[model samples]
Target: MTGPFGATSTTDDVLAGVTLTGKRILVTGVSAGLGVETARVLAAHGATVVGAARDLDKAKAATEVVRAQAAQGGSLELVALDLANLASVRACADGLVAAGKSFDLVIANAGVMACPKSFTADGFETQFGTNHLGHFVLVNRIAKLFAPGSRLVNLASSGHRFSDVNLDDPNFEHTAYTEFGAYGRSKTANVLFAVEFDRRHKAGGVRATAVHPGGIQTELGRHMTPEVTQAMIESINVANSAGGAPAFAWKTIPQGAATSVWAGVVAAADAVGGRYCEDCHVAEIVDGEGLRGGVRPYALDAENAKALWAKSEEMVAEAF
Candidate 1:
């Protein structure tokens, strides 16, 4: 469903006049980019935010502005997490559960973009492991802390259109690995994870949705050279032209994070539950080779989401 806001909306735009005095939110990847900005807006509006990062020092340095700008009852706290390693993921989840910390929202926003072929601390491919499996284990383990009316927003991308999850060879053991392809698989998992998680918990008033932040110039591109960045932009423009859509344009950090905040805090729960969102609205589903907008059908398929959930449990040797 379309909303009052669109691509140009900032986090503050969606959150205007909203008070979150008792809202407790957990945001991953708080060290930089959209994560920091998302936390900033939420906390600025009176929510208590717990920011998680792989490196506490980096997060500490990066989030000084968040602390400085927070108002109302807003506050920031940091937690150590390493999404590439299950041991660290479990420890973090266990610590939160042990502390009896409850959350009204959990944003799975940390992820690695296209990077050179590598493996995570686990045997899974780098992107698949760090971006998907890690959050899978961590979120599932800590879900007991999610009270009814809570929400989970996974940071997905339009890149899910690049490829669906290759469930059979999720680790790339039998498939040739390309940076974006693996990233695509992981992003798709982010969306599918939301679908399944929402299905599993929505009856109890918990819902999950995934959002694409749109293109932004951020540290997320640290692995890409200027030439590669240009090439990707050109490719996106070409596809947009084919679809008669507006050419690709980069959004500011605030604009990029608006959809996540909108979906997580402002939008009606039923509109986003178990769906994919972008541009601060529920995204339509599209098919074919086009990548200008909309989500792929398979990413929202109930059967596929269930299958991926089961396979994820098998790969991680844990059940939710």
Candidate 2:
């Protein structure tokens, strides 16, 4: 069912007539792009927003305008959080817990895209460690901070079409690593993480869902090279033709953020927890080569989710 919104819908559009008084939200990667817009809209609607970033100073400066536009009783604050560093994740979670803040929403919106081979301080692949494992450890450790009916919104991508999780060799220890392959595996992990997280915690009243926020030009693509860009475009065109699908489209920052804001605050989204959502609703599972839209069946595979959860726990060496 198509909702009342579309690709053109902005954060403000989805949040119209919505009052978020008494609600508290934590948005990671809020220093720029969609993250900043998401925080601004939520706070504008009366929600207390905690913006998390690697640089507290930069985050503060980036969000100064959002703070100025905050609704009465709404507020925005910055906290240090580097998803690539487990220590930073732990410290940030601990600080929030100490502050006695119970969150109504948690948006894991921070991520890196196609980049050179690298590893996090934890020695995990940079994309997987920062994008998936980082959020994995954060959510599990701070599980108690979410109030009943709270939503955990993970920002996944249609780029997940590039590959599924390589459980046996996720770090590319023996295999050749292409930039998009590593990035895709990390995104697929995001979807699976939400699936397993919801299965384990929904009984406690919290729900987790993953979202493909659509293709938007953002700083996240700063790492894209000319070769990678051309290859990506060619791949998408081939996929679209093979599947008889339309060409992919990009959204503005606000437009791209619509699904996240919808998933975070919409009751309809809570009802479909654990699902992969796109275009403001639960996405259809599709077959064939159209990497432009629809979710891969593997992304929502229950067994995959469970296995990923186990592996993630082992990697972090900490169980919550």
Candidate 3:
């Protein structure tokens, strides 16, 4: 309803006084950066968090950090996940199902950005494959385990403004791939995933949201080249100099995680489904800002979201 908790608001700020005792939250990409911060804050607020990472060792390290920061009786555990691989996603979900665990919140936060053109083991474009399809299947597979009143948040990005999904060639089979374009498509898919998921689940008391965590320097950029990173920095500096960047932008990890935490645990968000959020509140439609740092029309289009859902189902039919 209001602007996201201000750019400076940390996860701790948004989660203050929010008690999640006995609540089960599953957070992907929890080995580092905002994911780790999000898990730590949730656990500190009394949630039993299952932190999923691609690497068990990294997950262990992240759990240690969360455990150290946890409130007296809060808890954090780790599970292995690889969003790039369907087999891996299936294994992760199957493991959770086998453990008879259910979740109150599922944060689909793991993502790859601007990496070189690649493919998942199943031969789908790496970005679209990992960032979208994998999460799609994972969420659907675990949907039955999601309790009523549960929330799902996908970590979408302002980068989605660059491009919409190419329904004609989503797998890049017909056209040559570009890094940013693929990244944009993947991000757009993230929002679309939420859009369609809400349409199907809101009536069932399960809600979904997509969030653009304001820019924070995180490992998400590790795949970028030094030159590309420099160019991005210069562009941001120019924008800042020109008064384009938000005054309260460029968050610390804690700050970057605030919006997701708020969306996950706040009672105010109970009825707020299928919206793209930023800061700590629902985001406005971006006409001008969409090109800079907001959700694009195509990304949030309900029709397009449904279409993409159908396409994803076809692509991963066997896996699901």
Candidate 4:
């Protein structure tokens, strides 16, 4: 069921009148931007949020508002997780499983966008490793922590419009690499992860979905030079204005995080499970060139998703 919301709705707007008094959520990347706002708003609605970040100190400083504004019984705690390092990822997930806390939601929100080519501590491509594989291991390792009716929201991006995953040369080993190409691959993986995860767990009432939070002004673009950023912005605006649509505009952080909140707690489970969403509603499948929005069929392919899952397990040397 689509709701009375659009690209501009903020997290609070989507969550209005909904109380999360006893809900426990695990949100990755609480150190800044959408992550912080998502945690703050959820806590204000009385949900206990366990925030994960690479820099625990930065996360604590940034999440002060989450603590101060929390509704009664709502709280926030910081956990150490460097998504680039598999050892750290496993340790964090293991610790959480040992703690025995059940989570109503897990938002895989932390990611590095379009950074220079680099390898993770585990030797995988950086963007794919951190944004997709890191969360892959962490989430599956703690799979037992998912409460019945739980949800997983993977923060994908419109940048997925750039390209699909290059499983053959994920590290750019034999293929040339462009920053956006790498980013696109990772974002696509985020969607496929949701598709496969939702299929695997929905029977047990645990749903998974992918969301594009809309373009927002945030530190996620730190890697791009000002000129490149401006160029990308202009390109997006050009695309946005097609078909008489409004020119592109950066969403406020709250607005950018809204779809995640909506999918996690507000949308009907059957409506969003295994689907892609944006602007607080399920998105349609898009095709052809000069495209403005919507998901690509390849991203939603069940067989490809399963294949990625198998490849991911083989790469990480762990089975979920």
Best by lDDT: 1
Q: Candidate 3 lDDT, tens digit per residue, 67-104? A: 98777467988888998889999999988888887889
The digit string of per-residue lDDT tens for model 4 on 161-250 reads 888887777888998988999999999999999999999999999999999999888989999998998898788678767746677778
For residues 236-320, could you state the per-residue lDDT of candidate 1 as single tens digits? 8888898788988899999999999999988899989999999998999988774678999999999999999999999999988
Which TM-score value belongs to model 2?
A: 0.96
lDDT of 4 at 72: 64
> Which runs of model 4 end up more than 4 angstroms from their true locations?
none
User: Candidate 2: worst 10 consecutive residues by lDDT?
Assistant: 1-10
Question: Against the unseen true structure, what C-alpha lDDT does each candidate score?
Answer: 0.93, 0.88, 0.84, 0.92
Estimate the TM-score of every prediction. Answer: 0.98, 0.96, 0.93, 0.98
- Determine the backbone clash count of candidate 1: 0
Ten contiguous residues minimizing lDDT sum, candidate 1:
1-10
lDDT of 2 at 105: 96
Candidate with the larger TM-score of 2 and 4: 4
Tens-place lDDT per residue, model 2, 179-281, is 8899999999999999998988899889999998887888999998778777777888788777777776668999999999988887474655999888787
Name the better of 3 and 4 by TM-score.
Answer: 4
Model 4, CA-based lDDT = 0.92
